[model samples]
Target: MPQPTPLPAAWPALPTELDGVAVTPADRARYPYLSSSYMRVGTPDLILMARDVDDAAAAVGYAAGLRAAVGQVPFSVRSGGHGISGASTNDGGVVLDLSALNRVEVLGADLVRVQAGAIWGDVAAELSGHGLVITSGNMGDTGVGGLATAGGIGYFVRAHGLTLDLIRRATIVTADGAVHVVDAEHEPDLFWALRGGGTQAGVVVDLDLEARRIGEDDVVVIHQASQQIVDDLPGYVHAWGDLMRGAPREFTSFLMLQRLPDGRHLSVARNVWADTDIAAAQPAVSDFARLAPLVQHDASLMPYSGIVPTPRSPKVGQQHIQMRDALVDVADRALGERVAEALRHDVASLVELRSLGGIVADLPAPATAFGHRHQEVLVSLWAQPRGIAAIDRAWEPVEAVASGVYSAYTSDTRARQAELAWPGETGRRLRAISERVDPALLFDAGLTLRASAE
Candidate 1:
């Protein structure tokens, strides 16, 4: 039998509470599965699978102790293991895995208790039976902790606002290992920070969300449209944006635009009607179909759960692409031209534009940590990870026109990115709270406000 990898000499000992769930490299059976996230591969020195809130607290305390004794340690807090920023895993550090703490409980007609480790798809499925829906990301496999803590731009964002907006209460373990139950009434500062401040505030174990009533049975109309643009990509993009912005709150859409190798452009839109009213949704759906030259169009009224079904897949960092995003107030011709120009650089593989307005815009900017409520569109640039410089150059212009940044969609976690995600007053408040709660900056993974604060 092979011996387990020995712990580093300078590292602090693991807490006894975490011994049963800890996986070192020598535990080859479980180590591989827990070592990587959706966008990046990692070889963590220790993976602590927290069984409960107490275990989660213990993990934080252990990591904090290590940081105090040995200086900066790469500590990551992972929920579902599917993090686009790739901050959930790290090389030669500690990963506090909360996958085992997943639980979805319906406490009331509109209130639901969801563990951090629960996937958005599973939460949607559980709520579907009760005719309740919570707006989440496009992927069902995304962890609730990551999305709810960040900003959730989903198909119903125009109708329901962000996932963070629905957070009624949360249980978190801060850097000091103190378990805090925060809500609008209690620990208001931490509650404000927890909603959209990422993991910098602490490791959230679970959240109680106020789910929205979708209808009689969580049913909605899903329209998928495809267009082939042979010329003038900017014109078509602008038209699609116009239609989406003018559409009613009941409608939301996501557009993926890419240039094919044959010198043509492929524009696909996934449109969602927040209700089962087919007649009311057809007009906007029709407008989307006519954007370029429609090649395919499909619309069906189905349960919202069907749109975000949970698929069990292991995370091996299969998605190794470089991603950058910007939030803009309008998708006018100028923005469209900028997107086209970026693609022409041959560095970006594609660009995604997600509609965000309607009810989302109704929220006051200071309502939460995600203060870019007025931005109507989120533009994301994707590349093959050829070189950071090339992609950065390609995305520079687009970022110049953007009003804000969505941390979840971005891969760059540097201080620059942090400055964009939490800019000005928001950055100042989050920095103050972080300093008070985590003075040593032990929980400094993802977009670090501490670095930006400096």
Candidate 2:
């Protein structure tokens, strides 16, 4: 993990060597791999390495003054930089780099304060030492700011609600550069919007989140398996979905239909038990194992931090990785066939399916800006796109039944419309809030939805 220093209380002088908060042209090359490898996109003309809350506010103020097109802002906010879409970075715009704002401190017995740029990996590692946990994304290297504002889906989804559910309050720098610590009792509307809302309103400095015990006593057993599917694929997929839906909330699973680096076609299932009680978890795990006998499995009894995946930084080179997502109910029979056929014809494409029925679906659709609570699964299709049209075609089958797309994962071209990322009444409400709060568009990081609009 990178060491982060605190900001000074009063104004210092120009780009000081102490905190190194300000990024001049000379600093760009050192921070090249801005985020973990998801895609090779975006190159900012100017990068403001914010050292603290004040620096982040100043960066947003400077960018807001750039004066760009009618709809788009001239700057983008980069927190974790794990966004699959290159929204954090831009072709020729400025980037409000929040990396140095990484601070995680336990405020009380049940609450912790985390800065926007803090990585989930570092957060989890720190919490494990304290015997505490917060539901963040499955990947450790994901940024706290990006997923918290967007919907944060994680390994503990079955036990805890979405990551945003744990957020008690947040400190944000709005377009006008004023700092506001918002919560349900504070700025109620912004608080509501911030929960699972897109990052279109402002730059979040740090968040105060509710914490839970995830000590060794709270051991979680995870089973992961993958193998070539030599049998009937459609029936297998439906059976897997059915088994997962009927299982206990403690048992959450993710399935990936992909082509290996070799020519083999495979479907992988990674299921988890959210409790320490092994006997109570065995039945659900057993039912899922029957869905695919060919897949080899692995199980573990470990703490919450143990489940965080290894480093998720991008690879050495910039590769063209194109991905799309859809929130859907149970897979239609035809869609399964389409996926199977697609898998056979194009081994290069992959489909990832994640279960969503635990606390995620239990929440009201209007509770947050995440529009897919009614959905049972999220199907993410990946391809090394030759072009946009081809990627669209491969994703069509799943999208036909899509409730909506997950804003954090999809490309700007795919999730551009307000309705696509946040559907129904949620879309209308989000835009109204965004328009009211930041009309000048200071924080319009892609897949934008504002709970403030006319």
Candidate 3:
């Protein structure tokens, strides 16, 4: 009898019969769970859990072949497994699990190379020794590949631009079954689309990211339990947006109103930055506190990684029903109040507004696939409204003052979801590029513009 490879301390021993890739029903008993999105439930016919870049390429080849045989097939790749949209998994397709390839290596003091499957929390610990930081999602458990390609918005948001902005290079497995290393100069078109459009072109195996040097001692967090949006929900965005614009680039804030487990809703505000001299930074922090009716405010120096909430393991298969309206807007006060009122009365969910602009808007919209660069605030509403009627009412005010929407926040497979995510000229650009790079259409275009948007 041959022996199976000893499992990692965290994972169970793999069945000897199961190699790197596992098929359904065969591996189903031990490894049925895979993905973190709540929008859909699917049992993939094939699950290519790769052990390395070579394995990932082989999996991509298999999916490409299957997709080629049957037109418009569903195939997906999951990394940190925290994809908010249901695109992480498919009804009956392949899921290329990249977690096994997790590796983090510092190229030097200021650049880091990360495998696609690794989570940011692991990367943070790896980079902490170098006194370096990279802008990523607010959650430490976020996957590097998904967030990086989808345009990461994080604690260091206003301080640096989007995460994709710092990408130095990447190794992606194209449909031709070969790993192509791309950067600004190499395969620049594919690289440009990958910056914010996601895996429509290929599966990124690993990436080189530019790291900003900052130590644990330089990080600071400003927390305040200020006015509840409930008091003046309509007045929230304009006040917060005005504050975000006037505040120093060193500071970033998130305005949220969420329901507690006790069924009470409280508005919350949080600010983070990495800097020396708290006293020098005090006056600017005070400006944000006075924006709404102040309740409490505190400042403390912490680690760069400390800005993200403590990493929590996601519960697989435990789907939370949520409808999100993620938009970019200047946030008209009167319109914001209407949105707030709608949220307060109809939805039992939370609403979040993150500060945008600063370096994020400095680049031209054509610089990357992310086009809503002009907007100063991100309005995200997570709710389960009564029905189409209630949802329509809740979205009206938000859409009124918004420039455009982000596909990541909403997972519904609408007929024109692509059109909504990237509208007009931007959508046309993505469509044309997608056709050029992904002639097979094997890659999922859920996050891009609709192809038939004539």
Candidate 4:
């Protein structure tokens, strides 16, 4: 096993002035445990569990003071701790655990204020009682802060838009420890970064999101397509894109490849229809039903909240999975075949291509940090276990055909590959923003700017 890195000797002394705050080793252990996505294996130097926004501000103040002296600061705000790349953890640094700050306020029938620490499942369940559901992560275990900031893609994306698109306002604590409310009218630049830039700019404490009413009449269409149709999957995907171009705003669909319990590969199509009669929505999905024999088709009316699943605690020795994201104007049938061929060799490998038109493409590029506005499809490749060889083999074929990649889905080892993911001017702008916010080259775990030869 590799030895963990040691903390710097000049690291700032843990603040003892915090009221109602605990900084014991056991408390720090709890911080690492809050990470539902993955485990760091190594413990952090300290864990500050904040009860409110002021407590969070104090934590950031301590880190900022440490950076002033040490010339760098390594820390993260852990909310639901669902950062797939383990961006919320550092080998030797402070971790501000915001899970205790979970709170939700329903401002109106169409709006709500959610604390950063709240889980999406909990938020969805609360909102469902009022006949409201905001566009959130597909998995219920995702944190509000991480998902909202990192560009949320969920079942409702086709109908409503990404989670950030539904956000009306946000409260963030900056590098200087000042807490500010940001929206279209206030601190707009930081607000722009907060939407998609995620924790890169600051720790978002609260967010006000635009909610839509989705009742029990809403239908979640789920269908299973077999491996045999994998050759024809791209054509079906293109057809779905064409359908989206003409479909009503109430309908949205995405594709997924899952390894069944029996070790056989299965493709799933999840279609969400809001307010549209199932009879009316059936025609749009007719092309998918025609491509292959369906293993299971459960398209029925249900509450939007019913679709999200509760998250389990992080398991020990969980394999590190490498994920890659890309935007495509059209699904390349050749690339789909190549991915299918790769999966045949490695049963655990998978590829998911989702239609991305509807409301997603209508949003302007500068509307949020999520840059792939004009894309018609979103492609993602995943490989489990931490080995370099396995991940590289799984990604090679897909990378060959992908046009642009999503920065959030990438791995720490492939940080340099970000240049390839968000290429040219976009990559340069992200690097420049990283330099301005984290100039000392701290927070260099997953993706951070390093001095380049100019």
Candidate 5:
């Protein structure tokens, strides 16, 4: 494989000052540490922390001019730095960090504008005060920039749809350094692309999202654990899937596997239902509780904000972490056995099965860059760094059992994973859009761009 050329060191045509821009070694060090996701291996050549959108635009313009002059274009703008593929960092190029541009303004009780640098936690907190909330990622630390653009999924997804569904408008800085406001009425094509397009299109400075008022006090969250893997696991999954198929719009669930302190394994299932009839939703989740004695159950009504707890960062010292994902319609008994068998090999290995139906599957393909609109469930397999050989040995059995990959859960560098996520025509369309917006192929480093284009 050929190595990518490094970006130039000096800028000949850049202005002396860029609207209160700051570029120091400390700033560069901070940029390297800006990644929020688990993958943190690269460092940017230069860091330009912009104070505002003008400053951001100016910084981008300077980088573009320098790229044209030195025949080396930069990768992309990074906000919240959650890209799992390391797209936020460049080998020897400028990284336009938007973290400093965090700002939020409520247009009214029903709408607000958020800077790309802000995380979903801050947004939710600010909106909750006004009795309004926007659909956002389940993880509070996830940035609104990447999540909204990549089709935000969360606890509220069963009701309000993806995060992009709430977006009313956005201010984007195009590759040509021109700033444009996009919405359903204006620049509709660009708006369509931005919904689920990822960061390949451009840098979104600000996003205007529609907000809704729900019964925050009516939220019900339940967490239960299964002690043993029984033959009834598949039956429980099928029953849950059937319930979800007919579930009210206000209910959502996440089923995960966690390692117990005694070196034993347990399956933890969490369900959040906001309907008026809590007793009715209980029967849907009762089988799992029956399968194993309840470990900890919190089924009482609480505030909507209370349901979304603070997200914990990835554990340290776990290098060489590899994740595999799949979307399945039915959880087979044989597959469950294989998963249990794989878990016996290592302590850190986990199988996270998230129920996906209702609003998630009803959305149109072009609604956002999220292509898996028809997937019923998303299964993610993750392994920590025991060693490269250990990861290979543990992941092989799980990989063999999975049917397909989920785009969001899989790493961005895996092109094969993207192919499994998007399949044929959908993958081609996303690639074509990437080429059109980024003709010079500047944003191709860490993202799952077309391998042939590279």
Candidate 6:
């Protein structure tokens, strides 16, 4: 086994209050498991496993103190350690690990309180009994803090809005070690910034979310189908887009395409109907199946929790690929052509198209920091981590037609991506808020408003 690395000479001493929760590089067994994330490998000098809001505040205060003394220090706050950009972990930095703070509680008939460290799957399981569900990411392991604060585009995105839209209140620890429980009525600016501005505003410890009631059975219909694109890839893409554009608000679908070595594209689609009513689901599901010749197809009814089952596995950087995504108001033949071009250029190993625009568009753009409420589709690409220049070069076609970027889904943190993530007036407001709440940029991770300003 490799030996533990030493901390930087200038690294500040750990606060005595945090010693019980701190994990340094010296702990071989535990340190190795906590040092990395789902998407990238890291070797953080210290990992503070914050057990509560107080511990979270202390960690942030400690990092801020170090930055004040040394001018600059790498600091990151990690919830589930599943951020696609892998910004949650860093080499030779301080990681505020909130995994131990995971907790889910139902506050009322429709209100649920969840700790930042809790995974979406666990939240679903807890809320299942209540006959309520909150729209979160498709994956079970995604952290509540990261997705709820950024923007959650998932299986129910069309019926519900983004995860950020569900947040009624949040408990955040700002850079100055100040804990604030913010909502639309209290500290509204910070609350707005927290919803869609990534983590630049502060470290969110927990959130009070509004959950939507489902049927008595509390199940949704899932239709999964796959086909081999032997020819006319663009046509298939266009038809798929057209179908979704006309589909009912109850229908939401995600299509994944990957090029096989045999020079054919393998297309897989996951379609969901927010309700289990077969009368409303069958026609839309059939329309999607008719988009292409399917090699396999199946439909099932399952609890929302069934799809996002958590593995609770160790973080070892298992996903080794770079990802980029954009939100477009229209999914047309032109968009399909551009996606085909990107795939032909070997820019991505996998490309995904998720249908949006239902209740998601019901909210006005300026309602929260997560503008782009009018977008109709979310397109994402995944490729081997072959470096950013090459990926960006081949991604130009798709990016040209994009109206916005989802920062949480992309690994690119360049100024351009940041600008796309928060554009025009939205960018301006977010930058102002970040400067006020986190002037020292202690919680700077992923695509941020400060990066956009610069």
Scored by lDDT, the top model is: 1
TM-score of each: 0.96, 0.87, 0.87, 0.86, 0.83, 0.95
State the lDDT of candidate 3 residue by residue for 88-145, as single tens digits.
7776566778877789998876889999888888887778767778888677887888
Candidate 3 differs from the real structure by a C-alpha RMSD in angstroms, to one decimal, of: 5.2
Candidate 4 is scored at a TM of 0.86
Question: What is each predicted model's overall lDDT from 0 to 1?
Answer: 0.85, 0.70, 0.69, 0.67, 0.63, 0.85
lDDT of 4 by residue, 66-163 (tens): 77787655677778776766767665567787888789889976889999989898888888777777877677877887778877877777778888
| lDDT value for model 4 | 0.67
Candidate order by decreasing TM-score: 1, 6, 2, 3, 4, 5
Per-candidate total of colliding backbone pairs: 0, 19, 1, 0, 2, 0
Model 6 Cα lDDT, one tens digit per residue, 136-238 = 9788999998998899998889988899999999999998999999999999999999999879889999999998888654545464545645366778777
Tens digits of per-residue lDDT, candidate 2, 163-203, equal 88888989988778788889888987787777766576577
Error of 1 at 280 (Å): 1.1
Task: Write one digit per residue (lDDT tens) for candidate 1, span 1-454.
Answer: 5333367888866766677788988887888888999888999999999999999999889898888899887999999887877989999999999888889999988999999999988988888878889999878899988899998999889988899999999999999999999999999999999888988789999999998887766555564545556467778768867887799998898888888777677877777888877788889877877777777767887777777767778998888888999999888888988888788777788999999889999988878988688887999998878887899889988989988899888888778888888888988898899999999888777777785432
Q: CA RMSD for every model?
A: 2.1, 5.4, 5.2, 4.9, 5.3, 2.9
Candidate 5, residues 1-454, lDDT tens digits: the string is 5322322455553464552454434544443354223455544555677787777778777777777777765545767666554456555567787877668788976788999988777777777667677777566666777778776667777777778878899998776677889898997767776776666667788899987665442333332323443344445455556666666766676777655546455667666664446576676556445654555655665555665554645412123556666766555555555566556667346777676677777876546556667666676667775654675565565566554555545543566565665556556676777787667665555545464221
User: With candidate 2 superimposed using the best TM-score fit, by how many Å does residue 246's alpha carbon deviate from the native?
Assistant: 1.2
Clashes of 2: 19
List runs of model 5 lying over 4 Å from the truth.
1-14, 26-38, 71-76, 216-236, 259-264, 275-280, 285-288, 311-320, 332-338, 341-348, 386-405, 451-454
- Output the better candidate (5/6) by TM-score: 6
